[model samples]
Target: MARTEFPAKATHAQTRAHNASLVLRALYDLGPISRAAIARLTGLTRTSVGELVAELEQDGLAQEVGRGPSTGGKAPTLVSLIDDARHMVTLDLGERTFTAALLNLRGEIQRRATRNLDGADGDAAVALVHDLIDELLAGPHSPILGIGVGTPGIVDSEGTIRWAVNLSWTDLPLGKRLAAHYNLPTVVANDSRAAAFATFLFEGEDRPTNLIAIKVGHGIGAGLVLDGQLFDGDGFGAGEIGHIVIEPDGAPCHCGRFGCLETVASVPAILRRAFFQAAESGVRIPQSIEAIAAAAAAGDELALGVVRAAGRALGMAVASLTGALDVRRIVVLGSATVLGEPWFEAIRDEARRRTLATLARDTEVVNGGPADDAVLLGTCALLLTRELGLTVRR
Candidate 1:
């Protein structure tokens, strides 16, 4: 039997923070609501709700929007969140490019900037990240709430990058460094986990209690959301599925592994396979994923084969995930979604074939189509959840 460890008891400050978060969450989700209604919804006392609302008003996070309809004797004053009360600077350190954006409390991007990495690595890549942030911050924006980053790597909770093979980063204290430099709270997380949270939050009113979001691009990885919370394992590497070995005697991976999932299902992997097949068949060597997708759509056997093979690889991964976690909702996103229907069909077929019949029947794999901004938005989600307590579940 396994032993279970419980969390530390909440101190007075922690209790206050948690209560404040609950009250604020009520307003954020069901705002333009009266104090009595918030009290009822959150199960907090009316006095506590009032005090928290006053604090929020003083902080410019909430304000009396209007009066609600009279339920009986008199109309009650309604309070709502000031969606733009704070600004979040978010970054998506993509494989080929780095994107930064200024967003409001509602996760609406007010301004954006991009820097093509152009094969930069190590300190050079870090410099580009700084450049993008500096450019974005120079513009007009609301009061800075914090900085959030979605990067490719295994990241610890303290915002340290344990390793990011492509960027040649190892044991980097990126979050701490950024926080010290900017004098603001900072969160650094693996891109896939961030994307998973973004997907869960993007579901809005229909957000599920459990979901698995897989990002397939230059690398393959996933983020797991369980019980309405992002689940980071003991080492904060819960979703580092990209390095999972799929083929023992296959292509070499940057992580010094052979036949990792990324080697088969990632964008570069798909492209490599497609290019080789195109050349072997004496067809036009494809230059991009879009070109291969177009060819596949037009009934090119070679292109279809490449796309299906990649999807099949991903599907096998999905099967293992669902089999272990039993999460029914699986969202696939990133540069690879352009593979389209044939690719998706292959994924579904393989997942169904590999998974137990009962589990396969309920598993739904959907493309998060053209989620080009998912990483950026995901970072914003992290910031909002951590800094503002907007997405906390009771």
Candidate 2:
């Protein structure tokens, strides 16, 4: 057995911050209500809730909206979150392009910009990030909250990038450099983990406390949110499942391993399979994933076969993750998800067949489809937690 070190005892300041967060969370979820209602919902004393709300008002985070109907006497006053009080600069460093967005406190993008990296690397790649930020900062936005970045790689707690093969970056102190240069708070995290937090924070009131969100595109990765917090393994690679050697004798991975999960289940893998099929049949190769999905939907046997093969590969990985973590909510999102129903069915079937009947029967695996702005929103969630000591409940 190993020794387990518990967290340090929280100080009075920590307690106050936690209670204040509870109050803010209540307003975020069920806003425009009375201070009394927030106190009741959070189980905090009215005095504490009132003081916190006053502080928030002074900070321009909460404001009086209107009045609510009274239960028996005079109507009660309502307080609401100032969703646009602060703006967050968010970035999603994608495989081929880096996208930057200015979003309000509610995670709604106000302005957007993108830069085509086009194989930029090293210092050039880092410069592109600064360029995008400079454009956003020059635009029209009020008090800024700092910068939030979601990129591809194994990121440590302090935002050091261990490796990102395509970007040709290794052990990059990205967070520290950005913070020092920009003179604003900065948060950097693995894109997959960022997407996982976005999914969790936006999942509404009845959502589960734990989830596994798998992003499959040019590469494949899964982020584990356990007990409402990200669980980065001791090596800070907990979600690097894409490189797991699922096929000991399969094709070589960029990570120098053979038959890794990415070689079989990622978008690149599916496209490669499609190209082979098209070549064998003397048909034009799919120009994009949508083309393959279209052909499969039209009952093209070859296209369906290729799609199913990739789905089954992903399902195997999902089964392994579900068994190890026992997290029942699994969400699949990314470019490959465009394969839609046929692809999703194969994933679901293979996962159920491989996992225990009792576990599989109750498990719910859903397709989230497309990456969209998930990474951008997730990094913002991290920034909010770090800067305001509040979680993004909505």
The most accurate candidate by lDDT is 2
> Taking the tens digit of each residue's C-alpha lDDT, what string does model 2 give over 1-394?
9898655665667789899888888887788989999988989999999999999999999999889999998888999999998999999999889999999878889999999999899989999999999999999997888899999989998999999887889999999999999888999999999999999888898889899999999888889999999889998898898998888999989888899999998988888989988999999889889999999999999999999999999899989998887889999998888899999999999999999998998888898879689999999999988987667756
The superposed Cα distance between candidate 1 and the true structure at residue 197, in angstroms, equals 0.8
Candidate 2 deviant stretches above 4 angstroms? 1-19, 39-51, 71-74
Cα lDDT, model 1, residue 37? 95
| Ten contiguous residues minimizing lDDT sum, candidate 1 | 385-394
TM-score of 1: 0.92
What is candidate 1's lDDT per residue for 258-333, written digit by digit as tens? 9999999899999999888878888889999999899999998889889999888888899999999999999999
* Deviation from native of the Cα of residue 232 in model 1, angstroms: 2.0
User: What TM-scores do the predictions have?
Assistant: 0.92, 0.91
The residue ranges of model 1 lying beyond 4 angstroms of the native Cα positions read 1-15, 43-47, 392-394
Report, for every candidate in turn, its global Cα lDDT versus the true structure. Answer: 0.89, 0.91
